[model samples]
Target: MDGQICCMVMRVNLDCNSCCRKMRRNILNMKEIEKHLIEKQQNRVSVCGRFKPADVAIKLRKKMNRRVEILEIEELPVHYEAEQEAPIVNHYKYY
Candidate 1:
């Protein structure tokens, strides 16, 4: 999924503050992630980045030693600015 951005929401068992902290640390270490949000009350983790959804789920499961359910996966549009061309001007010399 190169050059593609996506958001993945997963349900994880965040029973305690330590669990949330561990999850936060692991997510922070992932270089591909642009940002992340954790809802402790909902026991959900939302990650936005350029990585595959399944890969993240697997990594979280392995690292947390907990069951992670993929709740949703959404492909986000990438916005790029168009390059502007420089205007040309004619110069005249009079003798």
Candidate 2:
């Protein structure tokens, strides 16, 4: 029972139009993870939802022709509107 976890995480800072570009870049990083696969050790890849579109995982698995483990997908919250910060007032209250 080896407790070591061997995996690669691809993190992308998302903006408006960068989603598509990040996805393509993340796909290429999969090959980098594959390079770490040696002997009996297992190498895995982790990608966020923004990096993966529909059916991308399926395509990656078929392309790699190897077993890929999908971990739990976490859903993040969306904040529609945020309140503006109040003006900062500095004073010696206890003076």
Candidate 3:
């Protein structure tokens, strides 16, 4: 195996117009889940992702229940193609 390590990103379904509240909730959940896995599996990992608030991470680490060390935090933008939608919809089926 190569010396480099691989990391996984939680899948979040959202569009450009998604509400801020929803986005925040998804990000928080991602971090919490990843942290739990790190503790359970005892794997060394560093989490770097965009759109995550520092305060939320700090608060979660403070709990010290599942994690005692603050996992490495870095800001990196996550980009992927969102599911496409039909440009137009037919109303005949609605009747």
Candidate 4:
């Protein structure tokens, strides 16, 4: 492998948009992550994507009393392709 490491944005898809909002809020509430988010907003942050399938499945199993398995985590939003095609480059530049 090359010495340089590859990185991608971290994203977790929940069952619904409410879950996504809740998770985003939770992430924003974290002191450590808050700082990183600030940098991320500026597009100056470096990070790698992670998807803890086992952990998520365990949580679901405990809550729903049913088995769950996470297939993968997406770095960008599910609608990333459409967003990327947006003409609003200015908004991202400021972010």
Backbone clash count for every predicted candidate, in the order shown = 0, 0, 0, 1
Q: Please list the Cα RMSD from the true structure of every candidate, rounded to 1 decimal place.
A: 9.2, 14.4, 12.8, 12.4
Evaluated against the true structure, the overall lDDT of model 3 is 0.35
TM-score versus the correct structure, for each prediction? 0.81, 0.34, 0.26, 0.27
Model 1, 1-90: lDDT tens digits are: 657788899999999999999999999999989889999999999998899999989999999999999999988665521122356676
Better of 2 and 3 by lDDT: 2
Worst 10 residues of 4 by lDDT: 34-43
Q: Using TM-score as the measure, name the better of candidate 1 and candidate 3.
A: 1
Model 3 bad stretches (over 4 Å): 1-36, 43-53, 62-67, 78-95
lDDT of 3 by residue, 1-95 (tens): 11222233322222333333433444357643333222223333234333244444454444322342443543322232122222566668654
lDDT of 1 at 20: 99
Clashes of 2: 0
On the 0 to 100 scale, the lDDT of residue 12 in model 2 is: 27
Top candidate by TM-score: 1
Off by over 4 Å in 4: 1-13, 35-95
Residue-level error in angstroms, candidate 4, position 71: 12
Q: Weakest 10 consecutive residues, lDDT, candidate 1?
A: 77-86
The lDDT, on a scale of 0 to 1, for candidate 4 is: 0.37
Per-residue lDDT of model 2, residues 6-90, tens digit only: 3334222333344434445556665323222111222334543333322445665555444444554433332211222356688
lDDT on C-alpha atoms for all candidate structures: 0.89, 0.39, 0.35, 0.37
